[model samples]
Target: MTEGTDRPRIIEYAGNGFVITWEPARCRHAAECVRGLPTVFDNTRRPWIVTDGATVDEVVTVVDRCPSYALGYRTADGRWRSAPAGA
Candidate 1:
């Protein structure tokens, strides 16, 4: 099911200030994202990324905190998500 298709899927790599994916293989786990944004990057939360943790706009800000591009974003219209400010 895609956006505007069936059911709305949960946003992945989403967080307050930014959204990102957990590329296990690519993830270096340098704790940069976590250190930068704890409220949104908590490990306890499943999927680990809460777009609603703050605001879609806010989440984009934090995801940029990630030194590595392991996390990403785009529009919610089935398009790949990207960080805000074009980070």
Candidate 2:
């Protein structure tokens, strides 16, 4: 959680081969993640982001399409691909 927000600024969902991080405040509702991989990014689900729903490669590909960079991933090897400056 950030300074004044009740919710976390970044939420993490981990799986076997990778870990996914989501920044709700940074999301622009473009739906690229949901459209690209519904099984993994289904907002209807309790946790919403389920990394086990898809493979590591699939998750990475879809997350990269995020226009606002609200979605990011960290590989098992500890490589992080997060948001850009000001995003």
lDDT score at residue 22, model 2, on the 0-100 scale: 92
**Poorly placed runs, candidate 1 (over 4 Å):** 1-19, 76-87
Residue by residue across 1-87, what tens digits does model 2's lDDT show?
558655448988988889999998889988999999998888888888877758888988899999988899999876778977654
Per-prediction count of colliding residue pairs? Answer: 16, 0
**What does candidate 1's lDDT look like per residue over 59-84, in tens digits?**
55655566655665654434444333
Model 1 TM-score, all chains together: 0.52
lDDT of 2: 0.86
Highest-lDDT candidate: 2
lDDT of 2 at 80: 72
Error (Å) of candidate 2 at residue 87 is: 3.3
Q: Each model's TM-score?
A: 0.52, 0.82
Each model's lDDT: 0.55, 0.86
lDDT of 2 at 10: 91
